[model samples]
Target: MALRDFALLVLVCMLWAGNNIVSKYVVAYLHAPPLFYAAVRFGIVALAVFPWLRSPPRPLWRLLVVSVCMGAGSFAFMFIALKTASPSSAAIVSQLMVPTTTLLSFLLLGERLSARRLFGICLTLVGALAVMWDPAGFDFSGGLAFVLVSVVMGSLGAVLMKQMEGVQPLQFQAWVGWASAAVLIPASLVLEPGGFETVFSIGWRFWAAVTFSAVVVSVFGHTAYYFLIQRYEANLISPLTLMTPLATIGLGVAITNDPFDARMAFGAAVALVGVLIIAMRPNQAMLFLFNLRNRAR
Candidate 1:
């Protein structure tokens, strides 16, 4: 890749990383309602991307399904998770989407997963469990379930996205933004009483968060990602993008002042290692040897 493109990739990662911190602050500090906040964020994105909605490449049904899964479904659960769970925890759990996507693709799309990938998936699941094993204040009752729901939805969306053809990234994003707004509006009103009024009364910090999510994270971050995906192979891109969760963890610690416990650190390391292995699709024997060497170091 060119230096310019590399720089752009870095910028995209930073935007995504910062989004974790923004989400935590918005839901926790600013007291934004998750569904309502997501609705507004996508509403703005819809408006911003409206012009590109003219000539969509994919079938309307497929596009709509993709939008529903990737936009409304993913954001709804993600916002709920961010509201209650620590940003670091949310970031780590979100990594489950990768393995989930792989498994789903094998089942639904008849895509083949190599033995190495399967092992990586197993490791990732184990790491996820380790991360979730916090004894002191682990609460899986409420919003965390929603986050897991989002992970499943996101995985489905990703697999479907691979089957889609001829859709430009911006066009796809436009569909996602508008469709998410459409679904989220009614859902927010029904699920969250007085949601519209609450959003209107929010302070500028909330608005800033909304703008960052809509413009910077959704627009710039996703756009850069699509650009990289277009330029490079999926395997190459996927491994590097794993850095997003790590970045989020760091940002969560710095911004939200979330505790950086050993469990979180160790689990994140393991999950990330597994993700890199799966994404890179290296030989299992080599990966095992490499892992052993790293441990010895």
Candidate 2:
């Protein structure tokens, strides 16, 4: 990746990391309904990008599926998870998106991972498991199951996204925001009573969270991410994006007062190293190994 592209991706990670904290605050602390908050956030995104929602792109059905998967399916599952799960735990579990995407790419897209990358994937999984080993609050529960499904939906959406052509991220998100709100607004009314009432009652903190997530994270951050997705192979992009979780961990500690123990630190280190390994091209990794051997000799 070019330096500029890498920097932009890092920016996306930061925005998304901040959203995890803010979204958790709204849902878990301020008692806003999860689905309702998501609906409003998408409402903001839909309005901002409504111009692009004109004619359907080339593949109408596939685009719709991608919209549903990336928008409503993933967002609903994540919001549900955030209802009970810690932000740090949610962030760490979400790194499964990397391995899930790579695996799907191998099966569906016929992409291949080098031996080193496979080991990196395994290492990252180990790190994630380590982080989840907390006895205090990290109990394996239904919330985690929702997050797992969320990762699967996101991974599948990204693979489908790679197959698409001539559809820019702006148009993609416009459709996502529009389609998701269409389904969720009604669903929120049916499933969770008092959703709109809660929205009206909540103050600036809620709106601030909604605006930051909708504008900064979803609109700009995900749009930038999808642009990269369209240009690169899924395996190449997915592992690098794991940087989001690491940033989330830090933000959780600072803002949410999440317990940051030694085990979490070690696990985070392992996961980040795994991400670097996967990010390195095969030849780059080979050269590093060769230099190491020469130094030892």
Candidate 3:
């Protein structure tokens, strides 16, 4: 990667990390309804990216499925989880996505994983569990459970996305934004009483948070990441994304004054190591697919 691209990647990670803090603040501290908050964010995104919505991608059904899984399903579960889970712990636990994606690829795509990758998956699971475990209560919290569900939704979307071709980042985001808003809006209205009222009462601060998340994090941050991944090797790009969690943890501790004990640190270290292993290993399927596309282009 060029020096400029590396810098861009770091900025993207920082923006994403800040988004975790912003989301936690919106849903937890501000007491905004999780689904409502997500709905509003995606609604803004849908409007912002509506230009790309004109030419629907082929196999519209698959696109819609992938959009819902990666969009509203993942965000709703994650925002709900954040109501109970600290940003630091949640960031560490979210590393499970790396392993979960690999496992899903093996099962759904019939992709084979090397022994090293299997070991990494096991380690990632153990580490995520460790973070979820509450020693005092002698049981895991529901927050991380919801997070696990969120990770699975996202992993499924990622696996399914491999079958999609010729979908630009903004176009995919447009679909996700519109589809997620469509689902989440009704879900929030029916499930969360007075959600709209509460959000409206919160005033401009609420809109500011939503705007930053929608425009900066969802649109710009994700679009920039897609740009980099297209230009570089997936393996090279994947490991660098670990910075997002680290930055999230740091921001959580500093901004939220989150409780981070020795156990939390250990879990984060272990999970990140596992994620690193999985990311560092070359992804033959991705490379082959991208190479073919690039040649055709």
The prediction achieving the highest TM-score against the true structure is 1
lDDT of 3 at 64: 97
Each model's total of backbone clashes: 0, 0, 0
> Which stretch of 10 consecutive residues in model 2 shows the poorest summed lDDT?
133-142
RMSD of candidates 1 onward, in order: 2.0, 3.4, 6.9
lDDT of 1 by residue, 183-263 (tens): 998998888998767767877888888999999899878988988998988876777787678788888888888777888
Taking the tens digit of each residue's C-alpha lDDT, what string does model 3 give over 169-285?
999999999999999999999999999789988888889999999999989999999999999998889989999999999999999998888878888988887787787755653
Which pairs of residues clash in candidate 2, taking residues 3 or more apart in a chain or in different chains? none
**What's the true lDDT of residue 89 in model 2?**
76
Clash pairs for candidate 3: none
Ranking of all predicted structures according to TM-score, beginning with the best and ending with the worst: 1, 3, 2
Assess every candidate by TM-score.
0.93, 0.85, 0.93
Where model 3 places Cα greater than 4 Å from the true spot, the runs are 136-139, 282-297
Off by over 4 Å in 1: 136-138, 283-297
